[model samples]
Target: MNGLGYEKMEKYYLTNLNDLLLCMKKAINFINPEIEYHHQQVAYLSYKIGIQMGMLEEELKDLLIAAMLHDVGSIAFGEELEILNEGDRANAHAYAAYKLLEKFNQFAYVASIIKYHHLPWNHGSGRSFDNERVMDQSHIINLADKVVVRLNRNKPIINQVNRIKHYVSNNKGSLFADRVVDAFMEISEKESLWLYLAYYPDSINDIMEYILRDNRLTVDDVVSLTDIFARIIDFRSPFTAMHSAGVAAAAVEIARHAGFSSNECKMMKIAGNLHDLGKLKTPKEILEKNSSLSEEEYNIMKEHSFYTYMALKDVSGFEEITKWAAFHHEKMNGNGYPFHLKAEMLPIGARVMAVADIFTAITEDRPYRKGMAKNDALKVIIDKTNDGDISKYISTILIKYFDEVVSMREKAADKAIKTYKSFTEQMKISQEDVFAMVAEKSES
Candidate 1:
């Protein structure tokens, strides 16, 4: 709450805009598998819509980013419940996302669009409707977000179109604006466009290609991107934010201290960030269950690593990353599920991931149990190694850098909290600013 005006606050953040976007996207994927593809559909559809509307390139790009991140606040919803269909969830993740982004100077416009991307057009009671307030980037994103989700996940093509029509007709003067509805209708009427967006929702390179083609970033961008991804993935569960990052930091430090090459350490980092991507498919009830699970629930939990493998193993450069990240469940003595890969069959990266996974799990708080003290957590990992369940090299390395790993994770988490606080402050600045800025940004 620095009393920094919204205008000034909007202009000062996002030094690494592309990296931030990429990270936010990965977070989106971690929260909802359906949303991963949905975000891309929104971005691509918004781009095509922008072209049709004769907008500038920068405007289109921003709209694309906003579209991709529209439901990002849903990450804060804690868990993905089976009964909470896309339409049934009610935490107003959009508002939460707006507040989060409002804090960071770089994302003011982006945040604005996210906050009310679902509102209806032209229903205001004789209010001043400037570009920012009624027709900016947020509007475009809002329209695209609705159109894309309906097109992809709701029902069959004909059913989806009809559903959209009904939704628009019912909410015409309430949640959605008139022009936004028009855009949604235009998209729905075009069967080919809808089909194309629905089918090719995302390729392996969807996020990578988007950033590279749009922003011209490269592999060196991984550090910042991974940091952002870890944050978002953790956001999927209040109990898990930064869990991937913490594991990555601990694993990397352990690997480096244990005489692995910088490249191997880098690989460990990637694996750590993605180790839990499969959890997206899990229902919140299971994820947050405090008591022990039923046999069926336990079996379902055992398959997360397999899901992670299925999602990433086919990417060109991600094979190793996939194997390592997915192998977190493998036991050294040939007793893990989904693939009983024993120690000799497991690569060094897999070994590191296993250690990192355990280390972070014990060190982090969970609904079922309190986090162990740092030394105690390290001792458990060490004892596991003694039992031949983990690599001694990785375990010994963990003990060596245990302090630094925990310290860095705490720092990253603290930074995210501060960022979210800043965003919340910005959202409360003025109601007029919210409506005006969100609309104009949507239009652009």
Candidate 2:
């Protein structure tokens, strides 16, 4: 039986999780340099394994997402998510994924499968944990995640086949569910699976296109996914916790004020939400540094805008929006970062994004400084525009509707602060409780 608890994540993607999946997966992988493409590999392996095990169509879909995001808890919660059980810290990320995933209505059941991907089969004890039935799909991902992590990247994939198979055989009843291992063995002998891993990154485009080819998405899908990225980006520090929300809100207003169509405004929001996508890869030391950044650190941080461009440029529907978001750092006379594009190249949307980003940055308080008052903020922006540092057309519109646009930014920032507080408050687990839960699992 599909556990009663596991069946409800059926609407997880609201049609297709591929809506903005490319950007989301790429950003998640950026958290650690060592695990590049880790999410994609896990997703592919899990998809093939689920198919071999005869999982239903929807279940396989859910399985694919869970695998791709299996490690998200590690990225989603940082400062506040402490793993007190140092001996069993590996389970911490999985547990964190559970906490975050369960909060989303559509994605809740998917949480049931992921919360225990690191849990062992233990000769059958793992089928249920803490008196709740664990989904079999969890076992499928358990086997897939294990195999990928153990893969020796240096050696040829074909050569490691036997060793991997032998390892799976040895642990069958103890470390993995017997049925799950048997299903993996059936697919493991296939030449295609090995070829996919052997020639990775090169095979990435083909695999991603094949998997996402039939996806049906709407604007809401893109918004939901991008909001997830925004939270991961903004939640990094309280000083800038609501920065993306403010930019997104302010950009939409600027776009609307500039006579952008309704659809264009929504796209503007998507771009605003993702403008800092590359910041995910920047070092935390640079992101949360209290004082002015060192010249070397500033240069390193400059790469974030380019990285953001790279992440979104390849996404299918994000063509125009990608430039708008990525170019938020470029200047009118060609002095801005990562790219030094002159005024002649940037479009109105790109120009609007640039000014909106500045508006949010100046009005938002930081550890070392206070946000400017309305008049002060306007003067600074107007001065920059006059000096050819920003867009004249866009800044003029902003100056004309100063109260309206700035008020919109403030409202967005206020909403984001509420979210940040809720997120942090929800995640505040004490050391004693965390250790107790781990201890309970060990003895189960």
Candidate 3:
């Protein structure tokens, strides 16, 4: 592509960071139904405190992003999400969030902030631990997190304002930084701020626009952000650690072979990466089940694609991507679920995604069995195609280039696994440790 062509393509995929963040907020909230909009409320409170503290526009944007994503690590907590919420300390989730964010160099600072978001500010003495000054942003997020956690949405702001203030005031120098506490105090005094938090939760993004008015993301930026969530989704279970990445690679190649434009192929890869965003809602036990799913368990599994659609459908620039990603489970015969659109309704991109999902699933190792041989995998897919459960044309294309496509999928999965291992290594934590902790906590 020429310079102008590249620029146009970039613009075609260009999206607001806020749009992506909004989708992510939905995905994270889907993990635990009880904590809807928890991230957004924290982001709003953090942004308000930042403004009250006279932070620069750029600083506020960073704080907002950091606050919104601070709990991303909690995805690893599985059923322990409620336990993590009830406890008040930095734990594995904090380290996991740090590791996840720090991979993207632009988010390194934000990663640091999230790492210590739960840390208490012991007056000025808390600023330096081991001769390092904790980022003030961490303290800001800490205070915001504390406030949002205790907020009672059912009560009127007027009734709760004084009580909330007194509570925060009591922990002024112990649980929170004095300056951050002061900023919260100043902002909380505004009835509008309290009302915004209590009533206009959806307006948090609108408020963010005032701080990030000109923010725009390139296709590459969106891909990077999606890759982060992809890890969060796949990393939830050892059985599917590299699942999304493998599917993305396979789908991109399938799109290319199907004569899609370069831009379409790129978008296909993104859709593949995010196709399982809703899988975050599935409990770890269901994902790792060795036996066939019970009817109830099967029904729960079927809801993932719907959740994926709910998360991505409203993202402004992700219209095609959302359809392709969310429709992966639909069959060509109109017998498939969440939506049962038949052969005429299923787009080519969605068809390719369905094939990619099946191909990757069977070809990749799972906890219960080894990855199938190439011929065996192809046979299963071809049988599905013959049964009218998948796209026959796409299955034929995959069969013809089976070796090349499989190579692409394996290479992509290898890279994702390597990247995952790097993060776990650096954090000095492993999936085994996290699972063990959850198991131990459950037994206790």
Candidate 4:
């Protein structure tokens, strides 16, 4: 290992922790544009409150990450909006988020916060695990979450402040910790706070930069973090469980054949893994459809790449990765989606990614059909090349090394599948169990 604790021979890519968190928040919220800034609002409120409560900087950092990702579990259910609005139904997602995060040692504390984000503050008795009290930070998140849900962005901040205060005040002792409530009450007194929350979406990013300015993550750390999100993006549907992994593997192989430097290859692999980050917003029904999609469904699918671009475009170190990943669907003739750049405008990395994407899709099984035979898949790709959709050179390379590329894709996908199963199987409580608890709680 080198000074960064990554393998010495491998090239590492680094990104700002706050920038990465913002990208992830955007990707997660892309599930519904109506709720695109919901996580940010919650995180912003939680951070303001944490500052008022005089939390240690490290504690605030943890709280900020937990708050931003608190609702990630809701993605597992089809009725995500319903799950978020209905207190009873939402707990399942919270538990899901907890199970998902706890598996990573670095995120265990954040997992604990997410696990009980919905739990009320009727003292320590309201939520416990193995007879331990839920962390106080969870209560702060709960308060921030509830406050944001009540906000009506269309209304003026002054018009909504009294109503919001009333709601929080009424639930203060029973639903939120007294200290947390006091902190919120202190911060809520400022008119600027409400203005920031209700009107200024960009301010959240500014706050995050101020808060995380001193902390820097190495390239290896960012890669590990992106890997977590890659799982979240692909694991949303079984048909796509290994899609990103396969693309990353194939892209790396193609880049190697194209004689990309080691660092460039590594960056290409990361881009390929995250190329589908916007798919998190695509509905599962659309993704799992066995037959060809209607034009409307296909249109929705095309937006995934656009969404990927929007999410990653702002990350300081991801300019190349963003273009490579988001431009995969673009064609040489300028017939691609979200953006319509012609061959002269497209970069080599983007062209390689486009080829890798098509190759992986044809070889991978979908919910409705079996994967194509090698010769047949190759023919389809060659036909596309002839039609000016992708690069003929890359297509030729894939065909020449078909078996080796396929083997690499398969190995990478298998490892991804194992990781997915491990995450699902390690959860001690099932979604059904969470549903039962919600039902039991509702009855009482």
Strongest candidate by TM-score: 3
For model 1, how does the per-residue alpha-carbon lDDT over 1-444 read when each residue is reduced to its tens digit? 122132243233212445445545554565566666767777777766666667776666656667777666666544442212333232256666665455554456777777656544546521223434634566666556655555544445655767767866676544555555566566657777656677765542354355435443222344444554455556656556556767777677766666666555666677777788777667667777878899999988887888777666654445667788899889788877679988898887788888878877787666557779976886798789888888887777778777876776566556655654554454345344544544533222
Task: TM-score each candidate.
Answer: 0.68, 0.83, 0.87, 0.84
User: Candidate 4 residues 1-444, lDDT tens each?
Assistant: 012233364444467777887787787667765455777788889888988998998898889889878888766433443544755556667877776677655578888889888777765455575476788779898889889888988977778888988888887667777889888988888999988887775577777788778655655565566677777788787788889989999998988888776667777888987999988888788888878899999999888999889989998878788999999999998999878999988888899999999999999877567789998998999899999999887888888888888999999888988976775664434555556655644221
**TM-score comparison, 3 vs 4, better candidate:** 3
- Residue-level lDDT for 269 in candidate 4: 81
lDDT of 3 by residue, 254-330 (tens): 88888877767778888999999999988778888989999999999999999999999888778778989999999
Q: Give residue 58's error in model 1 in angstroms.
A: 4.6
Which ranges in model 3 have alpha carbons more than 4 Å from their true place? 1-12, 81-89, 128-133, 154-163, 421-444
Model 3 weakest lDDT span, ten residues long: 1-10
**Which is the better candidate, 2 or 4, if ranked by TM-score?**
4
| Shift in Å, residue 387, candidate 4 | 4.1
User: What C-alpha lDDT values do all the predictions have?
Assistant: 0.63, 0.77, 0.80, 0.79
Global lDDT of model 3: 0.80
Off by over 4 Å in 2: 1-19, 78-87, 98-112, 122-133, 155-175, 188-208, 430-434, 440-444
- Candidate 4 Cα deviation (angstroms), residue 6: 15
Candidate No. with top lDDT: 3
lDDT of 2 by residue, 112-217 (tens): 8888887778889889977999998888888877787667767778888899898888889877899999988999988789768655633544555565567765
Order of quality (TM-score) = 3, 4, 2, 1
For all predictions, the C-alpha RMSD in Å is 9.0, 7.4, 4.7, 4.2
